[model samples]
Target: MAVNTVGYTSQITAGFRAVELAHNKKPIIVDHLAQHLAGAALHTALADYQQLQQAQGPGRSLRVPARNRIMDDFVLEALQLLQQQQQQQLDGDGVVQVVHIGCGMDTKPWRLQPLLHVHWFEIDQPAVMQLKQQLLQQAGAATATAPEPGGADLGSTTAGSSTASLAQTAAASDGRSCVAPAAADHEQQQHQQGVRFPLLPQRYSAVPADLAMVPLAACLQAAGFQQQRPTVWVAEALLYYLPLDVACELLRSMRALSGAGSCLAATCIDAELQQAHLRLPSQHYFSTNKVAWHFSMDELAAAIGAAGWRMQGQPQTAAQLARERYGRETYVALYGGAECCFTAVPG
Candidate 1:
């Protein structure tokens, strides 16, 4: 069956990373968490500022103004939390390994790479990865322009002129390094005569097999994760739809795969979530078969404890973040923070 996903939130991941980069001084793995926050801030601020005309409930009239406030508030809160976490682990081996599970179109790999220079990997369903590759290739092909040399202008074919050519060549080489997709598309169309994209051409090698069947511990071992150093496992807006047993197994896997210093960051739904938490007046909006797992904080904490990991300080709730960080008036009347963040360390 096909999955209905939040195509809008897909881009927010990169924005989250940018927010983290701008606000958090420490380094772990720059994922889209930052950009996500900033977008929330900007968007929520707008909602609050607008004050939508829809009447939601007796006391809950839907308003855009409230949405903006909530988004701004939580983003500020997340950034501060991330900054603290970064500093806590910075002086270590600096061998950061950030694994963005089910990572969408985030640019932490690109932006964070130049700054912290850490090893990063993006994991998702094969199709999503293919999309990423396509998008990246297109971006690479289109924005391949090289910067001009710093000289005022080269005069004559002197030794300096030779240096200019060398500089231009180096710049062009760098531009080619990332390979934007637009350039590739042009080439593909040129060679596109009489050729059609194959249908059902091949089956992918299903590694770790199915999510339901895979032994998490063994799979982690196979992936060289059991003993990897400086690993920070991140599951952004993932893990709600997983069965409770499977979720526990994943926690155990996190413990078994990570060494003493490994950390985990994930987002999950509240245990006692109400329909109001959905926040959208249009009850029929957003796909119903989506990933809001609705696990309680108590249950999640218990699972983490069982897996031999210690909880890090403070919990960040989407709702609490908005009201406290930006002010209650910044968000939409219908929009509330339904998700939250947690970080844990191995015991």
Candidate 2:
């Protein structure tokens, strides 16, 4: 079945990463899996994002690779700390966990290669997770089934051709072709057309859930989450879409599930931007999904703090990080001057 693309924010973000990868001279965060996972949706999403960027002027849009970089760096740093603490305490190579809440087509587990002694859990809406699974399976990223005796290796050659065939069929149906029209050789299209399979690591979990309806703790537990293990909780581009109380409750639940050495790295929105009348480009897309911004930076801090999380430092806005790290200046008004990123640890 063809995946529904309406209000599919995950595909759009994947497109944004792909755009960054293709256009930027030096990308802030390199998401190699972005384009492949995006597949047929890539061109449309790329065009939409490019239009938004042009209208917004200068820097980058909401899902800038630079913003992704901040969260990516935090995850790496958190992992390093978890590993060091494990070594010091003689914890016998305990599983270091990283959970991505609202993990929409994120390629972190694949992109952040060499994640030794670690387990990853990605949670998102059921349909969204389904879409991700389909894309990953199509891209040849999912674990392949074992072949029967005397049969071909289904995971490699056979699977590759089948996927390419599917890609070709889908593109043809849509009046588009994965093969670049300008390219003269059909074989080049065959090689470059389908999404390349990234190095599939040993430990990764995808949990399909509707955070509004299901209990986050229950979902995590079902996915083999260990409460006593060191974890890095990532809530990038989440939080604000929920009601204030619901957002706080979510934070509290994460706190309840957290063990020693667990920390949170999340992107935040300022209360100012959450004002109903504010017309940010991304807000229009979010509004269509029947979700609205609720938590401001201060409100988010308070929520996490009340949930037993303490901020590691002052929350830094995307604009700040972009300027400091990439030397690219952005209009504060673009993102409403919201320092939309921060990290926190258990109090």
Candidate 3:
């Protein structure tokens, strides 16, 4: 992939969300924002993904939104529990942190901010983050809330300010913090259209970094991630893109950075499906784009366990989630059983 290009998978994921939102009768997620951000990429990605699903079988396409909904539920549950725990600990409205690893055009903060109050951190490849920022600016999401004077402030509350302050202390020499740069003049000008995205400046931090090369903890800390705070780490559709060792270390780092009452949610192909069904199709379908599935959920779970997280339950396949919970027959046995999502908490 070109260095400037945000690559294909992120666009594809956004496209999948857009397609699901527009087409499905009972879509697992309702995300008009995804459609907005996806823009023209939606058409091409939809066509390509649909073709892949046709080759893979029916219901393959549904996996995207199903996994999304499942992960969304896990994070929401964690946020509720963590928020309550933190409130009790601090004797006030407690702050919980939600970190999205390799976040690529994700709209969770926009979707959940009104329902929950928490600090949001997004980390991703520089190219991907740049594209997302540009999209947000275009969509007027970045400038919905006016920045404080001098423009260093990035949150709407004291919790947001305090986190940014902590990040500034740690990264003062680098001139980076949990705070985002001031919006451009044009973006600020457009904000008057009564445009708003759910996450205002006060609680959202977007950091651009290549996780493989940088210290993940430092990147997050510099973005005002409080290690002692209860956090929910979301690594949706991210582990498979990384090499095995890198993925394992990523889990270890998450575990290390987390404090009490922390949890992790992730989705990946299990080793069995990798051997049973995905091995051939992955190469046939994804190789040209340079995308590859690296580690399975079992491998990831082992790493999670070693890193001090206990599995909440057996990993459930997308097919299983769709069939059992939603009571829909969106099952494709060939590859569906191989794709799985799971949640874990600190042991």
Highest TM-score among the candidates is held by which one? 3
Tell me the tens digit of each residue's lDDT in model 2 across 1-347: 45443325667678778887786666667877788666666786666656656777645534456678778888988898887888788535555788899888787876674465666777777667666777777676642222223432211211122223423422334221111122223223333544255433235566666777768786676555668888899998888777778888888899889988899999877676666325555445445244556668887776677778899889888878777866765434333445478889889
Q: After superposing candidate 1 on the true structure, give the runs of residues whose Cα lies further than 4 Å from its correct spot.
A: 1-94, 113-117, 141-226, 271-287, 290-292, 319-337
Model 1 residue 174 distance off true place after TM-score fit, in angstroms:
26
Q: TM-score for model 3?
A: 0.79
Report the C-alpha displacement of residue 177, candidate 1, in angstroms.
Answer: 21
Residues 1-347 of candidate 3 have per-residue lDDT tens digits of 23333445676667778887776666777877787677666886577556656666544435676777777787888887776676677453466788899878777776653333466787777777767766766765652233345545443222123334545644543332233333344234435655565353235667777776778887778665778778899998888777877777788899999987888988888776555443455343344245657778877777766667788889888778877777654534334445788888877
What candidate 2 gets wrong by more than 4 Å, as runs, is 1-7, 39-45, 48-63, 143-195, 199-201, 280-283, 288-290, 330-339
Q: Count steric clashes of candidate 2.
A: 2
lDDT (tens digit, per residue) of candidate 1 on 23-60: 33442233333333233333533333234323332222
> How far does residue 273 in candidate 2 sit from its true spot (Å)?
3.0
RMSD of each candidate? 14.8, 10.7, 6.1
What residue runs in model 3 are displaced by over 4 Å at the alpha carbon?
A: 1-6, 48-61, 90-93, 113-116, 143-193, 200-202, 272-285, 331-337
Model 2 lDDT vs. the true structure?
A: 0.65
Minimum summed lDDT over a 10-residue window in model 2 is located at: 175-184
Q: What 10-residue stretch in candidate 3 is worst by lDDT?
A: 155-164
Error of 3 at 311 (Å): 0.9
